[model samples]
Target: MLVAGCSHFAGRRPLLGYSDKGVQHADTAIVACAEQLQYVCGITGVNQISTWEKFNGGKTPWVRVLPGRQVIRMTLSNSRQLNRQDVIIDNVQAGHVYRIDVGSSGTLLTATYTDLGKLDSYTIHMPRFPLEPKAITASF
Candidate 1:
């Protein structure tokens, strides 16, 4: 019952062009979603949710769960070659629908939960170039 999705950057564009900045926008979106989930749903403990960047050579950022368990680990790294597209990011959810966005520089991982037939969603924003834990804030 694991859900997953991913996206990546392709082709070249001017450094300051819109296409080049798509990654940044995608990162922002992910961060926004995570915040919404945390604040709106009161989800405190986020166990291991896989992020796409881990596919590359990087240390996945993990969250500590109840007692002492790191559940979610998201990793990101730069590509070795200019033409080589780095593994942007991935979203993995167990028994839930995971909506993910893999941008050039970041990843947006979201999970939709169903409890007693009630639907709930949670999200996290992960950077693809370097693993840094940013504060999750609500989008609304």
Candidate 2:
């Protein structure tokens, strides 16, 4: 396969002498980079969070892009309210995955992920979508 042969022809020549392997790698990488951009281009701000405090009588959390409902949930004893939102701006360009969790109270939030290659489709359910609430409010 040309992909397998890429490194074998690495650094073969200058502009006057370019390897077909170099061209193939460049094209492949470009397309891959574009596809990756599409994934996040649709995700931003609170829309980045899968849960917010506006629903379920402010109890249950919301999940997106995942099947199977969460019938029950619990918070650990050590868990605490965030008090402020954790803003995360991530680029998965180098095969990295980012998890952004916005707690139901809208105060507690987290962002994390498994190894990029190891992450799965459903597990990576975080979609390129709009923010929750769509608006922020503060009582005067």
Best by lDDT: 1
**Lowest lDDT 10-residue stretch of candidate 2:** 26-35
Question: For each predicted model, how many residue pairs clash, with residues at least 3 apart or on different chains?
Answer: 11, 3
User: Could you give me the TM-score of model 2 versus the true structure?
Assistant: 0.23
* Candidate 1 accuracy as lDDT: 0.24
Winning model by TM-score: 2
Residue 93 lDDT in model 2? 27
Please write out the lDDT profile of model 2 over residues 33-61, one tens digit for every residue: 01121122111112223232222222212
Model 1, stretches more than 4 Å misplaced?
Answer: 1-71, 80-94, 105-140
